[model samples]
Target chain A: MIGATRHYEIDIDKVDHMSKQLTEEEKSQIYDDIKEFLSEELDVPADQITPQSKIIDDLNGDSMIYLELVEMFKKRFDVNVEVRLIGQYFQRHPIYTVGETAQAVYDIVERGDNLLADEDKASV
Target chain B: MDQGIELVELSALTAPGVEIALIDIERHPHLEDAADQFLEPDERARFVTLRSPHRRREWLAARVCAKLLAARKGLIAGPHEARIAQDRSGRPALVDPAGRAVTGITDCSLSHKGRFACACLGRPPIARVGIDIETVSPRLRSLRDAFVNPSDAMEFHVDTDADLALLWSLKEAYSKAIGAGLHIGLKNITSNRNPATNSLRVRTLAGRVAHARHVVYSNCVVAVCFIAQ
Candidate 1:
């Protein structure tokens, strides 16, 4: 599960603007890691996925599958990915290419990691 | 209130043979303080039940729903006899006791707002059922889009406040009725009023679930969903 966060470091601009609340590099790493993890988990070829792979249409991912992917990311990254965020992204943007997904992943990771880290440091 | 009752009766179409029970948790005494005894032994073993007042309300609501279901059907009921479990996203469900495969699917939904809690129960022979109720609050101004689809947004053109609340209730009810994770994405489903059919069409990318027979009582909006046998 932590494989995604460990795999690649992401760039800031690849993230969705509305979710640009976190660091660019952390987001980029998470995005690359998730795509790698997903490609492996889904048994789809790795090269088939890019920074913009559409989760549903291209990878043939379903809602439940996306959720499982998110859970794995959370397990790996130790971040709280609200279920509502998935809906927000799917509703707001249904882009299914790997590049698109990678971008989305970057946004989520950066925003998510920062929030988790802040909350963690605060509690300490 | 009369319209609300009619809506409830219509939503009752979800379960044909199974008995239905409705209870207001606010009416039950000591409900707000029974968190300890309310937990199932299994849950107690796992140490998941928290002592928060909100959890107490949820437990009380679950217990009350189970008890009412048992009483109405004349079945033996025990503490947590309904056998509740949550989906991956923590949505609640009641296990069917019939063991007959057909009898163990107890359909239910719970909603709480302010000091009140409400639940709806149905079973197979009865398709799927979900119900949601929420108190009207001014705070909803910021949460309207969180509840409705683009189509339903039209019907809400007038009383935006109540409309938003109703849509929110429908979203909860749909989630419960489907008994799936919130991943289904409330946006996937669209709601629209058909003036010709006088029924609310609740649709997803494919087809429709139950109709949104609207019912409101007090300061709450109650939406029920059910498929007829």
Candidate 2:
């Protein structure tokens, strides 16, 4: 039944990170993490995943899935994401590519940690 | 005296020579929505600005107390002038506004249900008062862990006919009496039915605050906390 769902592949290169840049290797790792999460949560094969997959429509993920994803991301990346803002971001600037969504998330974490590090250095 | 309401006969804690009146809406002019024209300019603005019925009840209760005082030719002109201030937890109190000594601690607590709103006013004899009436529902039985203190859980004993709703109400009233609200945490306070006094023993952070509990209507439970000044 899972195989019957239309398989979509996520193209990692399409996303424009602008000045907030993430290396290709870092971006690839994000895809690996998100792919593992989606496979386990949806009970679908890894090859069936796509970046353009609508979380609710294509992946059949609910609020609980989003919450689980949020927890998984926080635990894995050590970044704080407001649960309320997650739904809004997914609806507009979607992760149409596998690594793009996770890459976006990684860049955010990297920037936040760097800012905190700068503050600590300044204080010292 | 509301047709839907069964007016459980409640005794008011009136002071010596001070007048107190308990008028049911059915007996009065259905003054639930009635505005006090005698309000001061500031009071009028404040009262008008209030949007919620629950908030309006607090203001109306104070106004009603002021009117009752004025009728008796008391010292205070209006309820707002009756030295009303909020406790730390934001529970309202009628305190001495000026540094000068208050005539006596005239405190009042308002409770309303459906269409009937009741205000309990008293002097120093009745120090701190807190009352709560909760509508009994099947929901209380399922969600018992949320409100019930672990110690009180066994006492609740959800049998074929357990009144967990009333138990919850008594617990709430006890907390309100301390002016702590729910922030003090319900688990900190213990509630036990004292067979001797026929009142619930509500243990607080400091000591046990005596409670007078009553179950009214099959749908509701009422508990009042009595603290000595």
Candidate whose lDDT is highest: 1
Question: In candidate 2, which residue pairs clash?
Answer: A51-A96
Q: Interface RMSD for every prediction, one decimal?
A: 14.5, 16.5
Local distance difference test values of all predictions, in order: 0.54, 0.50
In model 1, which runs have C-alpha deviations exceeding 4 angstroms?
Answer: A1-85, A88-124, B1-22, B32-39, B43-48, B75-81, B96-106, B194-197
Candidate number with greatest DockQ: 1
For each of the candidates, give the backbone clash count: 20, 1
lDDT of 1 by residue, B23-57 (tens): 45555556544534444555444333333344455
Candidate 2 - CAPRI tier?
incorrect
| TM-scores, chain B, all models | 0.73, 0.68
Compose the digit string of candidate 2's lDDT tens values, residues B104-222.
54554545443334444446666666666555556354334334567775555643224675666666666666654443544466677787755567775575675555545444555
Residue-level lDDT tens digits of model 1 in A1-124: 3222354343535644334444566666556666676677556787777655555435545333454555555545445655565555544455455566555555455566342344446769
Error of 2 at B109 (Å): 2.5
